[model samples]
Target: MRASIESEDRGNSMKEQIKYGDDVLEIELPDDIIVDRVAPASHGGAKACHSLRDDHAEDTYEYLYGKIHQALIHASTRIEKCGKIVIACDDNTRVTPVKQLVPPIIDFADARGIPAEIIIAGGSHRKMTRMEREKKFDKAIMDRVEIMDHEWKEEAVFSNVGTIHAGDESIPLLLNRIACNHDSFLMGIGNIVPHSVAGFSGGYKILLPGLSCEETVRWVHYLISKFPSEAILGIADNPVRRTINSVHQHRKIDLLVNTVLDGSSRVVSLCLGNPITAQAQGASISRRVHGVPVNTPGDIVITDSVPESVDFWVVAKAVTNTKAFTRKGGHLIVFGPCDEGLSPMHGDALKRMGYDAPRNIRSRVKGGDIPREFLLEASHACQVGEVMEHCHLHLVASGLDVDAMASIGLHVITPARASSFVRELIEITRNEVTGRKPRVKIIHRGAEILPLQ
Candidate 1:
């Protein structure tokens, strides 16, 4: 029921002309930019509780336009028709400037002799569906930007295949797929959260599902969260990581655009050029003001008082990764308000993991044992739901009493202990050990922390 579409009245203020050098050009944009950010219907509590406005919306748009415009200028004056302009984006928005707003603005610029074509940075993700694809372009600009025929280029890779043993079903990890196949070109990614695996943001993620297959998306998401190599760092050099990068290198990536988000998800800093290099610099800046350091010591660190405006996806990312900032023995304190634990697609993946009730628990207790593969399948499922709640429903519907956590390989800390209550948990953890060194790490990634952009 929130405002999914912005009206025209909100977009009318910027019709004037401006001069840069001797050439004068008019800036044109929809007065009200309608944004429809999707949140889970059943478990929207965590993200819904936070403020719902895009605090950095205006600045993000301006920066995006500026980058395209600058690139257009360079392409027009210096380069020729053979040149390409690629803009990398994610599911964050259906309305893209290049596909929706830029053509008209560029037409005005073209009056001043600048010409450019916007190509979808469909490097490594799935293509949008009919309905989802419609929001990206109007009739006119849709013609201007070229949509790649398909999302991924299928390629077979010879590697050690392993089975993700979820429940009883063992899914195989197979070959690699590349999204875009360009020899060499300039690349610019929009923005993303600072993840442990990719290190900061804006590498080749915008195209993940959009370019990769369903299984590919599943594998990448699963491994990034549960794998051990992440602790060592520079895991990008690993075989799986290198293979993914090789696909991008094949595209001849030249420049990278990365956006830094404040705790409030505002665009505080924008870094241009060199994806990895820019991300390192931008992420460092992001942490200085918004990142809460790991300083406290507790068996279970409960992050209470989370603001409502933060999305569950970002919330899950922050809490799930708390271990990275926490001492080994400590558990995480998640104050998530949502009851539904995973995204819709992610939930489906979890179900596919095959969590039938275990024989032992089915007869003795209400709960069931879930294999690690089920956990891996459901790892990214923690969008906002409690795993127990989801499991309970699944069990009752399927007429099963209990499940095992081991079979699925997912280690959920649900059936939350009574001691987990923030006040009690803190007291217990704090009081247990004598002369215990306080070493706790808390990251304020949710909406509570103000956005730096």
Candidate 2:
């Protein structure tokens, strides 16, 4: 079952509760502070396939594999003869069920006497641990195919694939050597969800940020700072996505198996064909599933980054997604259990750069002030800066210390104190606006939903 908002009202006070990690956070607000509209979570109904549960008999790996095999066969013309195939799978941050997706592709390759391997497209994030691998993959599949993680720092694992000169910026394309050397490359990706950078995540993104070297990933991310407002959730034609598509021309993707997931992370729709076309079709479905139409911007927005937890890095998705629905200079509060801090590698870089606003960060990067090692992390800092530029950000994360949150220009608050702090902020806002009640919007699954205009 999908997690949803549960509300309880008593007298003049209204209490709304949402799942935050393993616990529930109760948000108490005065009736006036609450808005009539509370965005619903995208639980794509009974028509969509549910996750593998005892109640559902058809949600088995055998059924999923049949769908996967048909898609692969229809899209893959030469999978029967391809000597070496590499499967580009998403890292742990994504909810894609790689274990179920990989077996069918491997079976096809094995039948054709082709060798195949799985590469975890980690991008700049740290490598997945043994436990994470076990969680994502089944023992049977793990025993059959070799699985390796992309090492962005290791120079030998990458090869230069020319450069993409987009709008005065020359970004060198250094991709994973294994992916480039394969006779055929197949990408197993989740649907194109609303993303901070690429308009939607999936498609060519599985290559650029997924399997690219640090230089390629950093430069493209830095390019995103140029058009922060345009790079919004639910948009499919943003500058960052255009650049990613341009870079994709350097390498040919044989087939793409993209799945649209419901709120419960079940495979709802599967698209297979040319990577671009399949992803576009999946993105269309994603827009329908996750897009929430807003008649007007909210004065105060409260959201949580659940499921996409473990670090403030992924949790920041809630801020970016909420930014689209917030009024200019309004307060955006995000609460999550960021147990991994900012990020293991990018946290230090974010602190060093400070949240100097997006414009200032852009100028510095343009002038080459950012060090090479920190460029990828700086790109992330730029994203935070861009979000801060549009709204007053308040982050309530227990894993991150006050100093760390402050360093990133976020007002830190504990989960227990979030309601009180927001209540006071709304009261102050209401008084300043001549007793106008604040329009507060609560998003149950902020990271997953796309607030559209």
Candidate 3:
């Protein structure tokens, strides 16, 4: 809604507009080559409970409250004591409509005579600003319900909830104190997307990286950093997901109100139930919404990390799913507008290791070349390195530290210069190649989809 997509023709050339932050990128492609693009698909935007699905009734809250009420009633059946409940919501880094859906949860709590509060499971991202909070929940909802952000780094607020073994490693599980409190019934709200971590985001993930302590978060990230991007990016079930589930079981989560979003981040489907079964059901719908089959590979592929575009570290997620879209020896461009620069938390960590191959980084970590504090981000760097090895990777990032990006092996181009650069590159590549027309495909909002064959 911020800006309209406009297209035009310049004699045997194609110009298309893509959104970057608030600015529109008017990229023109040489018509001599084959041009194709695909975004994440949307369902009819239905609501589901258990195995049942239905159209969005006018009384959306009734369906939400009914399922929640039934579950809560069932949970409280034998107990006489008045219990407390907590609704853990995802931050703006995800496309989840946490603000819109939270009020109804509060109403459900009130009706059940249980005190309720909302915790933003930000997962080590920057704290949400007062302005951001206001925009997220509006003033009325903020005043009506208690809302607070999870302090992942604040050691005082975390509790060591024992340890769990993932593969051969036994890791200490530290989680948010409030979330781990047995007195509070947990209701986690999030959106499901094909994720590099946790197989897909939702289910028990609201506890793992979402509300877990700093070290625990780092451990999970580093654990999966061992695998190549293609090995785990779009997979629905993987080692990392199983590990997260193992860690999540330490805390008791009753209900998971997970959603599936379209390319535009609209809630295309809503799922309600416990984290395990509900999440499995939810991811199936998410796959349908975000999965795009690709029989023909593209010579040039572009993707933008919409759900998390704050910095190069997070925005590089566009490269995760879209890697499959780029054919071997093709070009991949990622538009990452890093508003937070490199990272607010990891000081010079990514800069120190930069982005490189997985085997090299793993060896460096083993040899203690990378500081213990930076191992978490080193996993992310491995992803970028994996992309660089297969194809020519270009980053169209505006706020990245240019010198650091260069040193780290990223071919970064500013948004202002991206159009001309892409056009010239396409023309040059076309001139050099013969027999077959090269393919150009741009995936808008790449964070959600799995580009499947």
Q: Give the candidate number with the greatest lDDT.
A: 3
Better of 2 and 3 by TM-score: 3
**Per-residue accuracy of model 1 over 300-406 as CA lDDT, tens digit each:** 33332233212233334434334433345454544433333333234444445433322221222224243433433443443212222222111100111124423
- Which pairs of residues collide in model 3? none
- lDDT (Cα atoms) of all candidates against the true structure: 0.37, 0.74, 0.75
Off by over 4 Å in 2: 1-11, 36-63, 75-77
What's the lDDT for candidate 1?
0.37
Give the per-residue Cα lDDT of candidate 1 at 389: 23
Q: Model 1 segments beyond 4 Å from truth?
A: 1-68, 77-80, 83-86, 93-187, 208-210, 215-242, 274-293, 304-315, 337-341, 352-420, 434-443, 446-453
lDDT of 3 by residue, 316-433 (tens): 7788778888888889888878878778776377877777888888889889998667768887877777778788898888888567778877778888889998887788778767
TM-score on alpha carbons, each prediction: 0.51, 0.89, 0.92
Runs of candidate 3 with Cα error greater than 4 angstroms are 1-11, 49-70, 73-82
Residue 155 shift from truth in candidate 2, angstroms: 0.8
